[model samples]
Every structure is written in structure tokens, then in C-alpha cells.
Target: MSVLLESRVNGANLYRRGKVRDVYEAGGDKLVIVASDRLSAFDVVLPTPIPDKGKVLTKLSSFWFGKTEKIVPNHVITTDLRRFPKAFRDVRSLNGRAVLVKHCERINIECVARGYISGSAWTEYKALGTVAGETLPAALLESEQLPEPIFTPATKAESGHDQNITRAQLAGLIGTDLARELQRLTLELYRFAHDYAASKGLILADTKFEFGFHDGKLVVIDEVLTPDSSRYWDAEVYRPGAAPASFDKQYVRDFLVQSGWNKEPPAPPLPPEVVRGTSERYRECYRRLVGKALS
Candidate 1:
């Protein structure tokens, strides 16, 4: 399969090119979101494009948006390319890799929910007995389950890593009412997804969500519950005291850390093995979660 690192829709006006997706404005209050095969680690886009990666991501997000829509409204208008605007409709390359969604005023907060302590949460808990400055039980292990899922909000940084913020701080940034709604929705979505993944022999360790204002109502925007936005681990092999196998970009992050490349722009290219392994991991994640092959 061909890797699409950059999408060329020819006539669609470019909205913005994110680390992994290229968005373009369709007519009316809609946008076409194209998931590219480009993978980003530590907020830095890698040069190598993983084959069929974009299709997996696009289809998986659509799968999840359908599953979780009853829990909350979302921005998706259609995932079917035939229904897209005239310019985007006939592009064969856009078949499974692009979605048409309503344009919304994005809420700049990254709504995070953690069922397990790991990553930055673990680092902070180990050092200061807190996750996002909120205290947790004493002596939690690296990947141990939390007492319950907690909602941790973060800033949506334009570049580099998003910074975790306390719930109260989130309230301060946004109004108290809006912050509470985001927390409620984030935790609820996480719980629903967590339970679903558990039955499928996977752990929904933690995940983040983005929301936006559309037609004067709040709705989930961007991608949801995909490996790119969530952390997953195999249920049978999961251990509390150690770093579990990741079904996300954490695999690539581990490689970068070992390669001793300072986290900076101009990131190093992946080796052949790394590229193939990463591609396999993304595909496997799709297969397990969506209950079908991404093809």
C-alpha cells in the first residue's frame, strides 16, 4: 500500500496541516479532515510515513464516533466520500482516509481522563505524590490502576507537548460551569470506552478528548479514542508495577529516547525494522479495537 504523508486534493482550500492530519475547508460550515500516514512522536512529526496508517486512523475514528455518539454529540457529518462536496467527492485517494465534519469553535482545552497512572501522571505522582497537582493515594505503582478514573485537563499547545492543568485551574481558565461539563463528559466517555475495550481484552489506560462549540452547543471534535489519542495495553500481559506494552506512539517515543536524540525539530528518520514494526502495531491496534481489518 502507498503511504500518504501529504494529501493533494487539488482544489480543496487548505485549512491547516497538523502533525498527522491535513484539514481543508469544504463549502458551508463544514470541513474535510484527512488523516495522513505521518506519525508524530513527542509532538514532533517523523519523516517516514507508515503505510495504510491514514486509512486505519480515519476508519477507526469513524468507528468510534459511531459507537460513542449516543453518549455525546460529535462534529462528523459524513465519512462517506460520495456524499462529500464536488471537489472532494471524486478523489479516489480520499476514500477511507478523509471525513466531512462541521466546523466548530474548538475549545482549547485537552480533556484528559486517566484510569491508570502512567506517563506524565506517573512521573508527577512519583515525584510529588500528585497527578496534575491533585493528590492521589500514597505509593501507587508505575502502571497501577487509580482509585477511580479522574479527569485531568490540559492546554492545547500549538507546538510541543500539551501541559497538564489541575481541575480548578481548568475552571479558572474556562468558566467553572463549562469546565465541569468538560470533566463530566470526559470521564463518562472514558468509562464507556474503557469498559468496551476491557471486554475486548485491552486496557483503556487513559485518553484525551477535544470539544468545540457548534450551532451553540458543545460537541466532541477532532479524533476520539484512537491509539493516537489514547493509551492501550493488552489485558493478559498488563502489569501494574512496570511500563506495559503500548498500542500507541509510545513505542516510537521509547525508540527516540534510546536513540538519544534530543527532543527537537528535524527528528531522525526511522529504520526499516522500526518503520515496519510501527506500521504493524498501528494495524494491530485497529484490528483489535474495531473488531475487523482496517482494509
Candidate 2:
């Protein structure tokens, strides 16, 4: 399988290189997003590119954007190659791995929703008996379902880790009214996606959403519920006290944690087996959630 570690579109002006997606400034208000096969673990982009990973991310995000559009407006312009400009359509490598979206001013907040106690939230709970400054009921085991989903927002850091902040701080940063509006949209989208995943025999442990303003209205932007942005667990094998089997990047994360490499730049290259395993897990997620194999 061919892998696009980096994109080189002929006519597009390259601007931003996100962890996974390459953002190119197309003419006017349009942006060409190329989802590279780059995999970022521990917030570090690994040297190896996973085969078909970028296609999976682009396809899965398109699948989800279709499902949740009624929940909120989104920045998607069109994924149809025929609809894209010639500069993008002429590049055959961009097929199924790129999207043209309307550019909008980002809200600069990571709106996260946790349906289960796990990940960084679990770490925070173990230390301070709270998740994001909100105290939780005592004796909650790891991976246990929260009494109810909580809207936890974090700073949208350009580099390194994003800091978990309180709702009050979120309001202070992005106005009280917009903060409340984003909180409402985030939880609604999460619950809707969570229930859908449950019916498909998967658990959406937690997920982060990004939003931006387009034409004076808040709209969902960037990637939606892909493996990189969400924690997906197998529902059949889920247990409250232990980490459940996941079909997301957890496979890569566990390997990196045990590989004895310091979590910093100059990250070690992933072994072939690790690369293949991670690729399969990402494909499995698209198959399960989208109900079809990635094209």
C-alpha cells in the first residue's frame, strides 16, 4: 500500500502542518486539508508512516460529519473529488485522503466529553479526586462509566500538551455565552455518537471536538470522532476496573510507553510489527464505525 507521509500539491500554498493533517491555503476562503499517514504518539509525530492511515482518518471524519450535521453546522465544503478544484483533483495521490473545507476562525478551545473515566481524566482523578476541577463520586474505578457525561474543555495548545481547564476559565477565555453554547453542542454530539457506537458494539470512552465560527455562527470544524481524537473500546470485553481492549491508537501508545524511549522529540522509529498493528487497528475502527472497509 502506498503511504503519503507528506503532501505536495502543485498549486496549493502550504501553510499549517498539524500533527496529522496538512493544511494548505487554497484560493479565497477555502483550505485544502491533506491527511498525512503521520502518526503522533505521546504528542510526538513518529518517524514511520502507517499505511492507509490518512485515508482512514479522512473517510471516518466524513462519515461522522454526515451523521452529526443536524447536531451542529460544520466546516465541510465537499469531499467529492469531482467537486474539488483541478489543483486537488489533478493530484491522484490526494484521492480519499484530502478534503476542501471553508476556512473559519478557530475558537481556540478543545471541547472534550468523557462518557467513561479513563485516560488523562483518570490520571487527574487519581491525583486530585477531580477530573477538570469538578469533583467526582468517590470509589470510581478505572474505565468505569461516569454517572453522566461531563463537558471538559482544554486550551488548544499549538505545541506540547493542552492544559485541562475549568468551565469558569473556559468562559473567561471565550466569553460566557459562547462557552455555554460550545458546552451544550459538545455534550449533545458526544451523547449522540456514544449511543450510536454502543449500538455498534463499541464504546466511545471519550472524545474531543473542535469548533470555529463561520459567517457569525458556531460550526464544528476540524476532525470529528476519529481514533486519533476519540477513545474507542470494544463493548463486549469492557470491564470497569481495567483498561478495555481498544481499536484506536492505544495500541501504539502502549508500545511506546514500554519501549523505554523518553517521551520527547527525536522519537524512536516504530518497528514493522508495531506499524502494521497500528494500521490494522485504525482500519478496524473505520470498518466497525462506518460499517464498511476503507476504500
Candidate 3:
């Protein structure tokens, strides 16, 4: 795997500098998205790179594109390093971590689906006894399994972290039809992926997906099912009442939590061991979920 240092798309207009990704205009209804090794926690990017982290995320997203294509259209065009155009071909070194995708008019919402109670869901449940701006049944405990998955949409913050919004708010922004479609598609995709991951002894706790309009039709965009986009927990160690041991970036989060650093400016760099461990966990997740060793 060669690591290309520079971008390939000419007339590349920088679109967004996300915490871990750089999106570039790829000329006419397309975008070149590059995943950096940058790791983020609490909406802050740490000052260290996790080796192979980008490659792992790219591969995982590729795997999921294939798995979920039956459910919805995706932005993926090609992953064959040699197939990229001349501009990108020379940058094959970065091919393992970058992708050229058809750009679409992105839906202005972050479509999230949760099967387990944790994270923001738990936080909201404790305070308001509901998730995603909706009330839930009584007797729900922290980390408990949700009776059913919920569609929790959040505004796609052009800058800074996204803020969660209610279903009604989502409908107001995108019209009731489109909002309902997003919700239905999101939950269906989550259910399919969650069951598949469960079969492999991993728990698909929750995930966020982005969608865009192409030819006036909805299509899934951005990366999916990667550690950076979703939470994975080890099924064997999963206990109902307690937080399950995570199979994704929880290790990094745990380290950060222990560091006692404010979750604000001047994010701290991770120790070498923590980076290695996180990278390994991502690799393990891809291998197990895809049932094939990543090249």
C-alpha cells in the first residue's frame, strides 16, 4: 500500500475540514474525500496519528458499501488504486485511505440510529427520560437495549460538532416525506447491519449516516460502518446492565477520560501504546465483520 502525500483532483476546492476528513470538490457532482490519521475525541482532534487508521476506515466503509448496496445507493465509485485517473493514480499511495465519490446535494441532517442505550441516548434518558427528543417507556436503564431502534436526526453543522434535533424539527427542515424516508431507511440499514455484526460476535450499538440527493434521488454518502462512524462492542463481554467493552475507539476515549484534560481546546496527544491499541482494534473489527483480512 503506497501512501500518497498530495491530492489528485485539480481545481480542487476545499469543501470542509472535518475532524478526521478533508473533503475536496472533485468537479461536477463529485467529491474527493480523504481520511487523515487524525483522531478526534470530544469534538477535538488529538495531536497524534494512529498508524493504519485511515486505511482501516476506508476498508471498513468499502466493505459496508457492498453489504448495504441492496438497501440504498452509496457514493462509492471505485477503490481500485490503479483505476483512479492520472491525477489520482500518482497518488495511489493514498488510495488505501482516500476515495473519489459522486457528490450530491447533502441532506442537511445527520441520520443516526441507535439500538442500545448509551452515549447521548443515555445522557438524555437520565435527564429527560427519552432519546432523540422523544419520550421512552419507563424502566429503561443505562446501557439497556432499546425496544426498537430510533431515528435521531441532528443538524449537519458546517463547522463544529452537530447538534441533535427532533423528528419534527427534521421534518420541518426537509419536509415530512423526505424526513420519514430518511428515518425509515436509516433504521432498516441499521437493523440489517446490526444483526450481521451480531452474528460475528460484535454489537452494533449505534451509528450515524449521511445522505445526499443525486438526480433528485436519495443516496447514502460519506463513510459507513467504520470505527470512526459507529460504535462496536464485543458481544462476548456485553452485559445488559453495564457498559459493554467497546471494540472501537472506547480505548482512546478511556485514556482521554483518565487524563483529566478538559474536553476543550488544546487536545492532548495520545500515548504510543494507546494509538497502537486503537489501530489494532479497528483492524480487528474490519477483519471480523468482513470475514476477510484487510490487504
Steric clash pairs (candidate 2): none
Question: Residue by residue across 1-295, what tens digits does model 1's lDDT show?
Answer: 6588898887789999998999999988999999999998877889888888888888888999999999899999999888999999888888899999999999999999999999989999989999888999997999999989999899999987798889889989999999999999999999999999998999999999999999999999999988889899999999889999888766678889999999898899988888888788888889998888778
Give residue 178's error in model 3 in angstroms: 0.4
Per-residue lDDT over 207-230 for candidate 2, one digit per residue giving the tens place of the 0 to 100 score: 999999888988999999998899
Error of 2 at 253 (Å): 1.8
- In order, what lDDT does every prediction score? 0.91, 0.91, 0.82
lDDT of 1 at 249: 69
Question: If ranked by lDDT, best first, what sequence of candidates would result?
Answer: 2, 1, 3
> Which candidate has the top score in lDDT?
2
The clash count for each model shown is 0, 0, 6
Those runs of model 1 whose alpha carbons end farther than 4 Å from true positions after fitting are: none
- Residue 284 shift from truth in candidate 3, angstroms: 0.8
Worst 10 residues of 1 by lDDT: 245-254
- For model 3, the superposed segments whose C-alpha errors exceed 4 Å read 1-15
Q: How does model 3 fare in lDDT?
A: 0.82
